[model samples]
Target: MSAPARRILLVKTALDGHWRGLSVVARALRDAGFHVIMGGMITGPEIVRAAIDEDVDLVGLNVGGHAAVVERIIAELRAARPELPIFAGGVLPPSTCRRLAELGVETYPPGSSLEQIVEAAQRLTGVEAGKA
Candidate 1:
């Protein structure tokens, strides 16, 4: 039997209700053999709790807020699970992307292709594409 798909937690870090970017990335990760858990518009504490409860291999944050909020979530996640791989995508400015990059969270801005994102998931989660 084939191995199980890697699990990914997809969360939005703000009250903003935009779902297009998250939806696309979640779909891409799923197509790449990741079982993505959608966490819509959650707070830092909520994200942390869900991350622990889900037992996912990767955490994908859909950030559409001030970098401070996103940073807080990153910090909390790091504190809770230092080894968990994280990547973010959304309406991020260049400066915000740089900030997140400094925190070891890969940022994918608007217009990032699904193929590239899927490839990134494989690299981040250590799950080879098309093997399962």
Candidate 2:
């Protein structure tokens, strides 16, 4: 029997309505054969709830706010699902990326390649790139 599909939840931490980046990443992940759930512009609690309810294998955050805000969301997600792998991408500064890395989230700032993002998703979700 074939293995079940891996699921990933994509969320925007800030209230920003820009969807171009998120859309592209989601499409790449979906094309890689993983189930991608887009959680648009939600709060930390909502993200945690959605992750738990959706039973997602990984969480991807589009961080467009201060590092502290993203940190808080990370904390919430960790509290709810400690083993859930989390990655982020957006307008992150060097310092913010460092902070998130310290918290164990892989950050993909502007100019990060789609291949790299896909590879990270594979690693994070424990699925082979094309097999997912």
Candidate 3:
């Protein structure tokens, strides 16, 4: 059998239970043949632990809270896994998106097409789509 696709850890950094954004993104990633681990409504610590424990190659954070909250999570993730690539999506405003981009965290706001997200996952994971 072929090896499993690269793993991606999908998480929500807020108390928000609205999974629409996460769901869509997760589906896109899966369709692109990624093994996505869903960490629902978790804290920053939880996110870090899951990423390490799962040995994920990429992290996709669904940011629903204030930028500061997501920033903390991003910081902790970076500190824990310096090489891990992180991408975020959700109700993030343009300013927040710019800040995230500055921190090297790619941000995908609402209405972002699934194709774009899948392409990014492939690039971030360094896994060719067809190989997955």
Relative to the true structure, candidate 3 reaches a TM of 0.95
lDDT of 3: 0.90
| Residue ranges of candidate 1 with Cα displaced over 4 Å | none
Predicted model with the maximum TM-score:
2
Please give, for residues 16-46, the per-residue lDDT of candidate 2 as tens digits. 8888999899999899889999889999999
Q: What TM-score does each of the candidates earn?
A: 0.95, 0.98, 0.95
Clashes of each: 0, 0, 0
| lDDT tens per residue, model 1, 67-120 | 999999999999999999999889899999999999988988988888888888
Pairs of colliding residues, candidate 1:
none
State the local distance difference test value for candidate 2. 0.93
- Runs in model 3 deviating more than 4 A are none
* Candidate no. 2 TM-score: 0.98
| Candidate 1 overall lDDT versus native | 0.87
Candidate 2 runs further than 4 Å off: none
Question: Which model is ahead, 1 or 3, in terms of lDDT?
Answer: 3
